[model samples]
Target: MPTSVSDRTGYWDRYAEGRSDHQASREEALKGAFGWTQYPGHGPGDEILGHPATTLELGCGRGDAVAALAARGVAATGLDLSPVHYARARERWRDLPCAQFVHGDAMDYLTQTDKEWDAVYSIWGAVWFTDPGELLPRVHDRLAPGGRLVFAHAPAVPGAYGVQGMYGGGFTGRQVWIYRWAYEPDTWSSILADHGFTDIHARVEPAPEPGLLGTLIVQSRKSRPHRMDDLTSSKV
Candidate 1:
């Protein structure tokens, strides 16, 4: 039980290029490994986040989704904490002018960047690693009006922290205790409401086995002032 989980870069760094190892082409990797084909922005660029929209992927490992978005004419930036992951992403999409990759802490990047985005998405990325209190507001601030946020998260397994349900594996072979806040379904909705996100929805996709909780596909739109008021009234 390694208690030192403050830094995850080293762990992810060694596993950065694992996506490339599994699938021959980037498109195949995105579909097989990431399930990008089933995401919101998979159709014509304009139908989802809007064509030529500015987008950001938090904890973007190898920048597969970012590269896909850029290919669809979106201005996409992939922020990753692992230098190896960042370098891999940069190299993968170097020729695409619309794609960019940055290596740094996700919260630090969000707090410092002045750029606003039309949409921000993550696929089991930093949203899990970071505290929701610190991460959500920064994300809300960075998204432009009408901006969308979506992420796929697995339901937290039943167990006490550090004792059970801890998952990790890499070259180091050290089993570090995973740090994740396991809250109920409504708790996620409450957090989003508090952060001024409207039209919040969570779809539970069934898990592979019975009796196991499924994945939560959460989606929300940045609420306008009027929408916020409406949400408040509806809650009361």
Candidate 2:
């Protein structure tokens, strides 16, 4: 796996090229899927997001889900590390006025942006690739009060926790690799709670077919502090 940002960007650019023909159509993109299950519309849908007015998607590959949310009247922005994916997304969904795509690293964007989002999510995206310990706090800080954080990715292989390296793309003989984080559902819940999140829900959903890997889905909300007026009124 490449350690530098520029190298990682090149890796994803090649990966995108290998899968260029796999882009979803406009109608199919409107109905998004959160997991890699073979079954259509399987697992949780966007309803778990709770009708957010604005959303930011970390590692929004191809920007299908971002476009989907925008179609539902949410102002959605997708940030990706792969320039190829970003360009493709912009050209494909340019008609959607509410949807936007930006090419950049997730951590850098999160650290620099002053804007807060009603909800932030990733689908087999940056939340998987980036270090949660470093990434979660930044995500929490950028969320509005009671904002949501949701993500879905494949469960870790047995005994494989934290950063795991794997090869990607269709390259033969060349070892093009990438790094991802993997944790059990319980560990994921604990990590979110420790990061000051409330209402944490993390679970593994079975794949549509037997012998296939299951998807790990996690959802949590930023805790809203109690107001003085509400406390005083409750005392009366």
Candidate 3:
């Protein structure tokens, strides 16, 4: 269970160049697997985050979603750590003025930028790849008051914390398998509550197949502002 940075960079750089699979397939699976409706229309019991606002997508792989959202009139910025992906995304969406692709660590970008967005989201992105304790607060800081944060992630198969799957016709190569944290729904709720988020909601849906693991989708709003020291110290 090594958490070295190199383990991620190496696998993702290779993944960026080697991914020949349809980007739309990946997006469709997420939308269907998570049962996502159009922006501002969400799963059952979850509040709509609103749409066509300034949005930031952490780990916006290949920038497909960014392009899609931009086409819908949302000002979207897609950030990723891999230059290989950054370049490809930039090239693919160059003509679309609404979509912007940036190359940098999501956390680093959050820490340095003075910009605040109306919505911040991730789809199986930095929320799992990085430490939640460190990532969540920064996300809170970057969102405007009343802004929403939505992210979706899936756990490994029951009794398993990690797995490896082949991709890109096997001709491109394989990516290194990385271990991801599997937290219960309550744990996610508690984390959001502690960080000054309100209207917190977590939904866990059964897997499509009998043996597969379910997906956890969490959405919360920055109801009000809190001091950094206060958010860091309290554990509720």
Candidate 4:
């Protein structure tokens, strides 16, 4: 199996205008998939974000959601490992007031960045690239005490993608979305629970498209100091 996945952010820089061949179609599909409705910042931007908010969009491909957030007047940043995609995101969100793009590993950038954010959200699923073991700790460090993380993940049976994109035309083939890890909701929940996030919730969304692919949406609140007290008060 081809182990090295395409560096999406870096990969986009090499593409025409930092977009894949299906960029336009993909946009239309997402628009069609979601009915082209604008979000009123029902995320961290739900209430407080309209004022001045910090948000991170992990693996932001062309930054559609980031643009959405900015449209709602939120200060948002996007991080992706592929320099190509990062460039693409930059171009997409360049007009926004608080939009910035970074090209690096999600874990590394989250751990290393000193900025604090109110919320972090990743759409179109990016958790497949994570190393599982290391992903939790690094994500924990990036979050503020009361931060929220929402991961829109694509779930599959374990080891399912060993054939599809791995054996394709160098991962550049149209409709090639090679994701590792079966990504059960419980698996991701346990990971978040272990990383000091509380109030975790996961739901399988209605497959907004006509297919077997599924989106497992997980939303977790980063624990505050009170959480430790909650655990400690269980004295007999």
Candidate 5:
């Protein structure tokens, strides 16, 4: 188990070595899927993004989804903590001018940058690994008005909630631990609402095949300001 950020980075860097086989084809990369179902293109796709002009992806593994958004002419940027993953994403999607990759922690980057995005998302990425109590507020602050936050990850096991620890890809004999959050769909929505988000939607999507694990998809928006006209009309 990695106790510090640097150690965590090393853990993921080592884990990335075994992920070459998981890289998506350029064509398929351009049309991304939100869930990890066996059936191709299953579950909600990028349309859930609602055509954001600018977007950010947290823990973008190989940068496929970022490239997919770039292909759609969205200004897309991916932030990953692993140097190896960052390098791969940069090399694989170099041709896409609108797609950029940054190597850094999500918390550090979000705190340092004043820039905002129309949408921010994670596909089984940071939203799973990072503590939502700490991460969600930063996400809300980094979104432009009416901007959205969307993420998907495997649903928690029965009665499991809050931070859960697990071993990373065990290709090697060394045991490495990583932490992820687990919550039911309704609980996830409540967490987002408590963090000042609006239009919250969180649901569990059944697996493509029976007996397989389902995915938890969550989406919420930074509340847009109330119109003064509407306020006045309501008062009248």
Candidate 6:
């Protein structure tokens, strides 16, 4: 069955049609502003993201990366689950010819949308879904054969995700994947491998500034059709 955007809209407020008025409602999609601080110099994550890259940001909130990418000559689009957030993104990067803002589920959009991209990425956003694993293959199909997927997720280390113990009170963090069952570094790696993504690479990046949580950036590329080892490391 084709992915339906409403399946997600129905769950989160301001995501469905009726939530239009709620855009001005109290409590924004994100409790705080996005874009705390960007990494300095080229790191391993940027190595895989590529230079002058055409990127699809899965949950591009407020367009920080979008604006930055546009400035760097990277063709980028921002897709998000919040119309409120997307509206802000649209207004912020209105003059950017190469940057587009979209209101939709990342997986559903990737699976059903008419466009294909050179890369797919995300920050700490809507990745905590009930079946986020299914998103990998859809990303695989939408990429340009050797395209890559890079994202920063919540740390998988213990004492994180509010778990009380190792397995931690049946915590298992949270159900970001319906079939995959949990959210962890291993879980993400295995999911990517199962979906035919190779050269998997990941690391936890602590924020340079405060008032934000750290992130784990995972970069993977398509294994077939061609090889671009140097191209994979391109970044602005």
Best by TM-score: 5
Each prediction's RMSD to truth: 5.5, 2.6, 7.0, 6.0, 2.5, 9.0
RMSD of 6: 9.0
Whole-model lDDT, model 1: 0.72
Better of 1 and 2 by TM-score: 2
Q: Any runs in candidate 1 off by more than 4 Å, and if so which?
A: 1-4, 17-23, 30-52, 158-178, 207-213, 225-236
For candidate 1, the C-alpha RMSD (Å) to the true structure equals 5.5
Candidate 2, residue 82: CA error in Å? 0.2
Better of 1 and 3 by lDDT: 1
What TM-score, computed on C-alpha atoms, does each candidate reach? 0.77, 0.90, 0.74, 0.69, 0.91, 0.65
Clashing pairs in 4: 9-82, 9-83, 9-84, 9-85, 10-82, 10-83, 10-84, 12-84, 13-84
**Model 4, residue 177: C-alpha shift (Å):** 12
Full ranking by lDDT: 2, 5, 1, 3, 6, 4
| Candidate that beats the other on lDDT, 1 or 5, i.e. the better one | 5
Q: Weakest 10 consecutive residues, lDDT, candidate 1?
A: 37-46
Task: List, residue by residue over 7-27, the lDDT tens digit for candidate 5.
Answer: 688788887887864476777
TM-score for candidate 4, please give it. Answer: 0.69
User: Candidate 3's residue-wise lDDT over 53-113, tens digit each?
Assistant: 8989888778776777776677889999878888878887787789899898888999999
Model 4 spans > 4 angstroms off: 1-52, 158-179, 208-211, 227-236
Model 5: lDDT to the true structure:
0.85
Whichever of 2 and 5 has more lDDT, that candidate is 2
Evaluated with lDDT, which candidate comes out highest? 2
Among all windows of 10 consecutive residues in model 5, the one with the lowest summed lDDT is 31-40
